[model samples]
Target: MIRIELDEAALGATRIAMSPLRDAFCAAHLQLPGRAPSWPYQEWAGHARAVWREDDRLRPLWELFTEGPPGVSDFLMPRPLGTPDVYEELDQLRATDPAFVRAQVAVCYPGMGEEPFLRPYLTDPQAACAALADAYAAWWEEAIAPCWPVMRRLVEDEVLLRARTFATEGVDALFGGLESRARWERPVLELTKYIDAEYAAGERRLVLVPLVFAEGCRLYSTDDPEVLAVSFQARGAAALRERTPGPADGGDRLGLLLGRGRAAVLRELAGPLTTAGLADRLGLAPSTVSEHLSLLAGAGVVTRHRVGRSVYYQLTDTGRSLLALLAGEGVLGTAAA
Candidate 1:
């Protein structure tokens, strides 16, 4: 098992509320507007997935799965499956949990009027948002309030690092090979556009850019009765190697997964297609593509949609953020900072 040492020094370095990349991300995000323009169908699953991953609330679920239990499933997977998310499971697990909910809640820097991204939402600005807008941004904050800090501590490190690095690197060639190799396709401007759309719709969804990767982690399939039961746990970088590297470690072979075929898959559909379509185009099996989609979706890069019989995919708000990061928009901080 790996231990998390809460060093004040490390926290001090990471705790900056408004880092350099945040600014560049905003500017770069201004690029995407009216993407496909309210088409016959809404292929915005990418935006949805991206929003979920980037939010501050997810931190709790992550930390719990990592540091709190013998089997990570105690924090994530359900027993035979009641509900998919673990918000309910926590009530039972809270009593003896070493990394309780309270600590997880701390890492989240509240964005309501605190950060520039949220400043527009704090008041009656030029755009009058709808009630749905008001409901979204504040929901998860309340849900995981008990364990915000734990998640906060672990999240956004790699995300912020990549963001800053993108700023310094050439914007066009920012994310190394994430785009060309991973078929990562998002313009930073698109993210702001989505947020603006939500705000205009009166929906108050909070948008964050924290990148979540299942790399260095295992994938749970529908065939698996129990995910954590069979899966192994990796503690930080060390323990992860002992079992199987987490998706964050690139266990998913994310680079190879992102390729020209993925790009064509999206373009050929005229919108978005199911995982099977993507797989066929990539010259890989459907399951292989699904795995890639999961990683991409988790990283706030791809989008997902459930059609009548199948689920389709696309890029999201966070995907746009990464595009900007890759474009050298916000990579201004020191390498390690």
Candidate 2:
């Protein structure tokens, strides 16, 4: 069991952040033998399977992720403020200290440090770091970037809900309710882990990260003596299913008010979707969806963000309120609810 003893000063220093690459890395763990299946990752697994067949560059990363690497990954997840970024962390990995990299290489593979991919770390640490960075980028482009919007939205929503929990139920209840294995007593929070150890938080802060794809809660201490990071599985994991729009009916207020085509576009925009994705879902041309999206943006109903070459659309607050009202009145059929 791991027990983190936080003093009164450390209690006030607690913070929360979300990581994109961390979730992607953890998703790799699900591909290993004896790992439990999760419903939220089914779509990701399907995509990853298809990508793995086409890309061989990611084999090293997949091999490393399939087994234990206890003290090896601490550098990839540094403690900081606000949302932790994947690209930023990858940059940090590129700049890791050579001595530390050498040490972690031994820790990562132990008896297998002579492996071909890990051999560069023993000879030229800089070259090894660069290769690792390239591998991460390749994996991200193939398996992560395509579905990051959905994962990001889920992580953000979970954080907002936890913040509400901390506000309404007090910090004690919030910590106590975090995971089944975590217990919050007066000055210490204990986690049931395989290895038993104790860490004292004298003055440094504790950073809590909510992860969408973590197998379970894990802890990491930073080079800075002032912060510790705890990554726990984000709530609502099983609910992240495919959100396809239902069959449209013209005998409704939403359809009559916005017209059938625009109404369907708005409904599917309940979650983030690219113009091409929406066109594919609704059986309309990309130009037709783009025209509808432009109109919706002009009317303050949808907001768009460019991810790579594609623009993803999601409902604004006004759009959500409109949908909520429609759903409440049974005008959107059963799918909206």
Candidate 3:
């Protein structure tokens, strides 16, 4: 168990962010031997396995992330900054101090830095950082980028939900509901892990990140006194592989009543999604989705909010209740409800 002691200052400084690089790393970690991805990711894992086998350059990263006899190196876990850009996080990884890298490698690998597979990281940490960054970029492009859109939306929706929980409730409620593996006990947040450790989060920022690929909770902390990050699996991960119900699909009462296009739109709005995203998922024109969204919004079933430049629509309480009632009536699928 790892107990993180958070003072009032630490609690105040706590924030939630998403990290694409961390998602990539967690996905890679799941591909290691003896580790199987969840059922929803079987297809994706097959493709990622092919990429890992074909790319020799990714071997170091693979070993570093997955082949950890002790554990993954903390330095490789980039600090979460709430940015969706993977390149920005990769830049941070590329800029890590050589001495810091060596020190972390020593702690994680323990006297194996000079080994043939790990020599590059210890001998010339700078070059190693650049190489690892390049490797990760390639890995992301080849394996994770194609699926990042849905993944990103899932994580973004999670952050929004968590933010709301933190706002309406308090820190205790927010952390209490984070995950089952983590227990929030007032000033102390206990995380179940492979080793026993403790961290005094005096004034350092506490970053909470959600990953679509993370199977369980992961803690990223060091002696640096900068930030303590905890990453856990995000909700709606199964949606990645779930096929959206079309209007033509039989036994869709919601579709029959709302029209297939509108029903599909409402179903996807379980989490906030943009018109373009809804269109892409439902194979409808953006204008058509906009029409449906406009009607739904006017009917008080869905509400729209603007985040930066994009507008997202989500289901209201009435919408959720309607879905639930329909689900109970055997009209809508459980996923839709």
Show the colliding residue pairs in model 3: none
Q: Tell me model 2's lDDT, rounded to 2 decimals.
A: 0.68
Residue-level lDDT tens digits of model 3 in 1-337: 9888999888888899999998888788766777777776777888889898798878768767655574766667667768999999999988988888888878878867667767888788888889889989999999999989878877887887778667777797789878888999888999888888888768467888899888722645554558778888787666555464454647777777788778878877656678876765666788999999999999998899898888888887777776667544332332221
- Point out where model 1 deviates above 4 Å: 1-130, 167-169, 177-208, 211-337
Q: Pick the candidate with the highest lDDT.
A: 3
Off by over 4 Å in 3: 201-203, 216-219, 242-256, 259-261, 267-271, 277-288, 329-337
Give me the candidate number with maximum TM-score: 3
Estimate, for each residue in 1-337, the C-alpha lDDT of model 1 and write its tens digit.
1111222332222221211122111111221232231221122223333443465544433232222322222212222222223333333333323232222222222322344332332342222122212222233333323323222322322233334444455333322322211221222111211112211211111122221122222222111222211111111111111122222423323223454334333232222446654543344577767776676777666677674566666555555454345433342322221
TM-score of model 3 relative to the true fold? 0.85
* Candidate 2 runs further than 4 Å off: 66-72, 76-81, 167-169, 216-226, 243-337
State in Å the error of residue 79, model 2. Answer: 4.0
Top-down TM-score ranking: 3, 2, 1
Question: Which window of 10 residues has the lowest lDDT sum in candidate 3?
Answer: 328-337
TM-score of each: 0.20, 0.66, 0.85
**Clash count, predicted structure 3:** 0
